[model samples]
Target: MNISHLLRQYEQGHRDFPELNLAGVDLSKVMLISVNLTKSNLMGINFSRGFLTKSNLSQASLNWGDLTYAKMSESQLIETDLTKANLTGAFMVKSVLRSAKLSGANLSYSNLRGANLSDANCCGANLQEINLREANLTGVNFNWANLSKARLSCAVLKQASFFGSNLTDAFIKEADLSHTNLEQVNFQNSRLSYSNLQGANLQGANLQGAKLRYIDLREANLQGANLRDADLEGADLTNAIVDNADFTNATLRDTKVIGTQLKPQTIQKNLSELQLKRNPNYAGSFELLSTSYAVAVFNKDNSLSC
Candidate 1:
C-alpha cells in the first residue's frame, strides 16, 4: 500500500501493518503509534522525525533506514536489523532491542535511557554523546564502537565485550561490568567510580587520568594496563593482577590488594619513568613509603623526596 493509503487507514483507526514491504518509502514525520510492523521490510526508508512510540517492529528490517530524531520510545524492536542505519538523536527510551543488529549504525546523541539492548551486536556503531543511563546492555558487543562522552551510569553491562572501543571521558559510574572483556579499550579520563569491575579483563587498556574511586576490581586482570595518574582511592583490588601495570602517580589510598605480585621497584619505576619523560629535572632521590596505600614524599625542586 502507498503512504497516503496507509495514513488514510490509520485515520480510520486501523493500526495493524504487519509484514508490510515499504522499502525506500519516505515516511518522515508520520505518527504510527501502536502500529504493528513486525516482520516488515522497511529497508532504505526515510523515517526521520517519525513518531513510532509503542510500535511493534519485531524482526523487522530497517537496514540503511534513516531514523534520525525518531521517537521510538517503548517500542519493540527485538531482533530488528538496523545495520548501518542512521538513528542519530533518536529517542528510544525504555525500548527493547534484544539481539538487534546495529553494527556500523550512527546512534550519536541518541537517548536510550532504561532501554534493553542485551546481546545486541553494536560493533563499530557510533554512540558518541549517547545517554544510556540505567540501560541494560548485558552481553552487548561494543567492539570498536565509539562511545566517547557517553553516559552509562548504573547500566548492567555484565559480560559485555568492549575490546578496542573508545569510551574516552565516558561516565560509567556504578555500572556492573563484571567478567567483561575490555582489552585495549581507550577509557582515558573516564569516570567509573563505584563501579563493579570484578574479574573484568582490562589488560592493555588505558585508564590514564580516570577516576575509579571505590570500585570493585577483585580478581580483575590489570597486566600492562595504563593507570598513570588514575585515581583508585578506596578501591578493592584484592588478588588483582598488577604485574607490569603502570600506576605512576595513581592514588591507592585505602585500596585493597591482597597478594599483589608487582615488585616495589617495578611499581615505583612507573612514576620515575613518567617524571623523567615529562620533566628532566628529577633529583633521583625518591622513596616509596608503602605499596598498599602508596606513600611518596616530594620536594620543592619537583623531585620525589624520602
Candidate 2:
C-alpha cells in the first residue's frame, strides 16, 4: 500500500483499489488511467511503460508481471492470473481478456485489435508478432503457442486448441477455425484465405506452401495430411478425410470432390494425370477436378467415412 499511499489515494480520486497488495512493485512509466486494480496482488509488478487504459485488472495476481511497453487499451483482464507475464510491446486494443490466464506469457509485438479472448488459457504462450485482428478467440487454449508472424484476420477461432503450436507465417484470413484442434499443426508458409475449416482436426497437418484459397473444408480431417504446394482454388472438400493424403504439387482448380471417399483407381495411381470433371461412376455425381501430382486413398467402408 506504499506507492506513496497508492499515488496519494490515486490523486484523491481513489478509484476502488480492491485488495491491493502490489508486491514487488516498480510501476514504470505509470499513468494508471481509470484504474480499479480489483483483487490485486500484482506479483513481481513492473508494468513497464504503463498507462493501463480503462483498467480494472479483475481477479488479478499478475505473477512475474513486467507488462513491457504497456498501454492495455479498454482493459478489464477478467479472471486474470497472467502466469510468467511479460506482454512485450503491449497495446491491447479493445481488451476484455475474458477468462484470461495466459500461461507462460510473452505476447511479443502485441496489438490485440478488438480483443475479447474468450475462455483464454494460452498455454506456453509467446505469441510471436501478435496482432489478433478482430479477436474474439472463442474457447482458446492455444497449447504450446508461439504463433509466429501472427495476425489472425477476422479471428473468432471456435473451439481452438492448436496443440504443439507454432503457426509458421500465420495470417489466417477470414478466420473462424470451426471445431479447431489442428492436430500435428504446422501450417508452413501459412495464409489460410477465406478460412472456415469446418469440423477441423487436420490430422498430421503441415500444409506445405499453404495458401488454401476459399477454404471451408467441411468434415475436415485430411488424414496423414501434407498437401505439398497447396492452392485448393474454390476449396470445399465436402465430407473430407482423404486417407494417406499428400497431394504433391497440389493446385486443385475449382476443387470440391463431393462426399470424397477417394477411389478412382486411387485417383489413377497417385494422379499421373486424372482430369475427370464428372462421371467416374459418379456417386450421386460430383467433381470439379483439375489435379496435378495428387494422392488420395480413402476406402475404409467409404460413404463419407465414419
Candidate 3:
C-alpha cells in the first residue's frame, strides 16, 4: 500500500499499520497520528513537525533520526533505539520510553513531563532546558550529559549515574535521587527542595547557591563539595561526610546534622568565622565545643577525628 493510503488507514482508527520501511525516508511534517510503527526501522528519518500523537514506536530503530519539534505526546517508545537522534523541542509528554537507548541524543527543550524513561541509556545526551517533571528516570545513565536548566521535579532518579555531568540551575524539587552517583557534577544555583538523596555519592560536586531545603542527604558522601552560599535550610545531613567541603556563606538554618562532625578545631574555627561573617545573627556555640573536643581528641589519640 502507498504511504498516503497507510496514512488514511491510520487516521481511520487502524492501529496496526503493517511494517513500513521508511528507513531513509524524509517523513518530516507527515501527519502520522495514532500510527503503529512498532518494531519498524526508521533510522535516520527526519520526522520534524510530524504528528505522532498516541503512536506506538516500541522497539523501533530511530537511531540518528531527526525528530525536532515533532509531536509525539502519549507515544509508546519502550526499548526504542534513538541513539544520537535530534529530538530537540519535541513534545513527548507522558510517553513511554523505558529502557530506550538515547545516548548522545539532543533532547534540548523537549517536553517529557510524566514520561517513563526508567533504565534508559542517555549518556552524553544534551537535555538542556528539558521538562521531565514526574518522569521515571530510575537507573538512567546520564553520565557527562548536559542537563542545564532542566526541570525534573518529582522524577524518580534512583540509582541514576550522573558522574561528571552538568546539571547547572536544574530544578529537581521533590525528586527521588536515592543511591545516585553524582560525583563531580555541577549543580550550581539548582533547586532540589524536599528531594531524597539518601546514600548518594556527591563527592567533589559544585552546589554553589543551590537550594536544598528539607533534602535527605543521609549517608551521602559529599567530600570536597563546594556549597558556597547554598541554602540548606531544614535539610537532613545525617552521617554525610562533609570533609574538605566549602560552605562559605551557606545557610544551615534548621538543618539536620546528626552524626556529622566537624573535621578539626582550626577548620571549625575557620568555618565559624566564615559563618559569623556571613550572617551576624548566627549563634552556633556547638562549633566551639566541637573544636575543643576535636583538639583534645587529637592530643590524646595522636590522630585527628573526622
Candidate 4:
C-alpha cells in the first residue's frame, strides 16, 4: 500500500493494517498512534523520528529497518523481528517486546524504561548507554551484547543469560538477577547494590570494583570469577561456591559467609578483618587447617591456643 493511501485511511479513523507489505517504505517523522501492523512485512522501512505510540506491531518483520529517534512508547512488539534494525536513541518506554528478536540491532542510547523485554533475544546488540531502568528483562538472552554505561536499576533479570556481555559501569542497583547465567560477563565498576543474584551462575565473570552491598548471592557460583576491589559489605554469600575466585582487596565487612568456603588466599589476607565487630577484644590469627577449613589461634600467656 502507498504511504498517501495509508495516511488517508488513517485520517479516516482506520488503523488496522495487519499483514501489510510496506517493505523499504519511508514513513519517517509520521504519526501513527494506535495503528495495528501485526504480522506486517516492514523490512528496511524508515520510521525514524516517527510517533508510533500504543501501536501493535506484533510478529512484524522490521529487519534492517530504521527506527532511529522514533517515539514508540507503549507499543506492542511481541515476537517482532527487529534484527539488525537501527533503533538508536529511540523512545520505547513502557513498550511490550516480549520474545522479540533484536540480535545485531543498534539500540544505543535508547530509552526503554519500564519496557517489558522478557524472553527477548538481544545477543550482540549495541545497547551502550541505554536507559533500561525498571525494565522487565526476565529470561532475556543478551549474550555478547554491549551494555556498557547502561542504566538498568531495578530491572527484572531473573533467569536471564548475559554470557560474555559487556556491562561495564552499568547502573543495576536493586535489580533482580536470580538464577541468571552471567558467565564471563564483564561488570567492572558496575553498581549492583541491593540486587538479588541468588543461585546465579557467575563463573569466570569479571566483577572488579563492583558495588554489591546488601546483595543476595545465596548458592551462586563464582568459580574463577574476579571480585578484586569489589564491595560486598553486608551481602549474603550463603552456600555460594568461591573456588578459584579472586577476592583481592574486596571488602567483605559484615558479609555473610555461612556454608561458603573462602579461598586460602582470601582468608590469609582478610581473615583478621573478617572478625565480628563485637569480638574486637579478641586478638587472633587464622591458620589454614585444610583446603576448605581454617582454624583461629589466640596468643594467651605466650602460648598459641586454638
Candidate 5:
C-alpha cells in the first residue's frame, strides 16, 4: 500500500490494520503511532521526520530505510532487520531493539538514551556523537563503528565489539564494558572514571590524556597503546599487557600494576623529564633497557634518543 492510503487510514483513527506494506514508499512527516508492522518488507523506505512512537515492528525488514530525524521512541522492534538504515538525528529514546540487525547503519547524532539494544548487530555502523546514556547494549556488535565524542555514561556494553572504532573524546564513565573489543580505538581525552573494562581488547588503542581514575583494566590488552598524559590514579591494570606502550607524562599514583608487562623505557625519558618522575624507580633500569630496544622501536632516522 502507498503512503497516501496509510495517511488516510491514520487520519480516520483506524488502528486495526494488522499489516502495513509501505515498502519503498515516501512517508515523510507522517504520524504512525501504535501501528502494527509485523513481518512487513519495508526495505529502502523513506520515513524522514515521521513519528512511529509505540509502534510494533517485530521481525519487520527495514533494511536500508531512511529514518533520518524520525521520532521512534518506545517502539517495539524485536528481531527487526534494519541493516544499513540511515537513522541520523533520529530520536529513539527508550526504544526496544533487541536482536535487531543494524549492521552498517548510520546513526550519527541519534538520541538513544535508555534504549534496549541487547544482542543487536551494529557492525560497521556510524554512531558518531550519538547519545546513548544508560542504554542496554549487552553483546552488541559494533565492530568498526565511529563513536567519536559520544556520550555513553552508565551504558552496559558487555561483550561489545568495537574493533577499529574511533571513540575519541567519548564520555563513557561508569559504563560496563567487560570483554569489549576496543582494539585500535581512539579514546583521547575521554572520561572513563570508574568504568568496568575487564578483559577488554585495547591493543594498539590510543588513550592519550584520558581520565581513567578508578577504571578497571584487568586482563586487558594494551600492547603498543598510547597513554600519554593520562590519569590512572587508583585504576586497576592487573595482568594487562602494556608492552611497548607509551606512558609519557602520565599520572599513575597508586594505580594497580600487578603483573603488568610493559617495557619501562618505552616512555621517552629525554623528550620529557616529568614523565620519568611519575615512576622514579625506573630511571636506572629504563636507561639500560632503552639502549637495547631504542634501535628496534625507532628507525635509523631517530634523533630523540639520549
Candidate 6:
C-alpha cells in the first residue's frame, strides 16, 4: 500500500484494487487502464513498462514478478500465480489465463495473441519467441517447456502436456494436438501443417525437419518418433504406432499406412514406388507373400490394396 498511495488512489477515481498487499512493489511505467487488481499480493512486483489495458489480475500473487515490457491487453489472469514470473517482452493480447500458475515462467518474447491459456500450468516455462497466434491451449501443462521459436498458429492444444517440451523452430500450423502428451517432445524444425494429432502421445518425439503436410496421425503414438526430413505429404498414418518410428527421408505422398508398424517389406516397397510415381492407373491390390513380405492395402476409397 505504498507506490504513492497507489498513485493517489488512482488519481482519486479509485479503481477497485481488491486484497491489495503490493509486496516489494515498484509498478514500473504504470498506466493500469481499467484496473481492478483482484486478490492482489504481487510479490516481488515490478510490472516493468506496464500499461495493463483492461486489467483485472484475478487471484493474483505474481511470485517473483517483473512482467518485463508489459502491456497486458484485455487482461484478466484468472487463478493467476505466475510463479517465478518475468514475462519478458510481454504483450498478452486478449489475455484470460484461466487456471494460471505459470510455473517457472519467463515467457520470452511473449505476445500471446487471442490468449486464453485454459487450465494453464506451463511447467518449466520459458516459451522463447512466443506468439501463440490463436491461443487457447486447453488443459495446458507444457511439462518441460521451452517452445523455441514458438508461434503456435491456430492453436488449441487439447489435453496438452508436452512432457519434455522444446518445440524447436515451432510454428504449429492448424494446431489441435488431440489427446496430447508428447512424451519426449522436441519437434525440430516444426511446422505441423493441418495438424490434429489424434490420440497423440509421440513417445520419443523429435520430428526432424518436420512439416507434416495434411497431418492427423490417428491413434497416434510414434513410439520412437523422429521422422527425419519429414514432410509426410497428405499424411494420416491410420492406427499409428510406428514402433521404432524413423521414416528416414519421409515424404510419403498420399500417405496413410494403415495399421502401421511399417514393415511389410517396407509397405510393399513404398507402395510400389507410390504406385509407379503417383497412380499410373494403379488399381490397388497386392499379395506376394512367400514370406518375402508384400501385403499392401490402403483402401478408404483412395484404393491401393495388396
Best candidate, lDDT-wise? 4
Write the residue-wise lDDT of candidate 5 on 87-141 in tens digits: 9999999999999999999999999999999999988999999999999999888
Model 2 agreement with the true structure over 1-306: per-residue lDDT tens digits = 789888898889887887789878898998878889888899889989889898899888997899987998988989898888998889989889988899889988989888998998999899998999889989889988899889998899899888989898889888999878898889888899889998799999998888998799988998888887787776788888878877665665556667666544333245444443344553323443433222232232222211
Q: What are the per-residue Cα lDDT tens digits for candidate 3 across 1-306? A: 556776788667887864667786777998877778988889998899998999999999999999999999999999999999999999999999999999999999999999999999999999999999999998899998999999999999998889878899999999999988888899999999999999999999999999998899988999999888898777788778888887665666666565566443223335332332112232222132243223111112222222
Clashes of each: 0, 0, 0, 0, 0, 5
The lDDT of each candidate is: 0.87, 0.80, 0.82, 0.88, 0.81, 0.79
Instruction: For model 3, name the residue pairs that clash.
Output: none
Off by over 4 Å in 5: 261-263, 267-306
> Which stretch of 10 consecutive residues in model 1 shows the poorest summed lDDT?
277-286
Clashing pairs in 6: 284-305, 285-305, 286-305, 286-306, 296-306
Evaluated against the true structure, the overall lDDT of model 2 is 0.80
Error of 2 at 288 (Å): 6.7
Ranking by lDDT: 4, 1, 3, 5, 2, 6
**lDDT tens digits, residue span 140-225, model 6:** 89888898889998889898788887988889898888778887789987898998988898988898888988889888998887
TM-scores of the candidates in the order shown: 0.88, 0.38, 0.86, 0.88, 0.83, 0.39
Superposition error at 292 for model 3 (Å): 4.5
lDDT score at residue 175, model 1, on the 0-100 scale:
98
Which segments of model 1 are wrong by more than 4 Å? 270-306
TM-score computed on alpha carbons, candidate 6: 0.39
Q: Which ten residues in a row have the lowest lDDT in candidate 2?
A: 297-306
Better of 5 and 6 by TM-score: 5
* Residue 78 shift from truth in candidate 4, angstroms: 0.9
Q: What is the lDDT of residue 233 in candidate 5?
A: 71
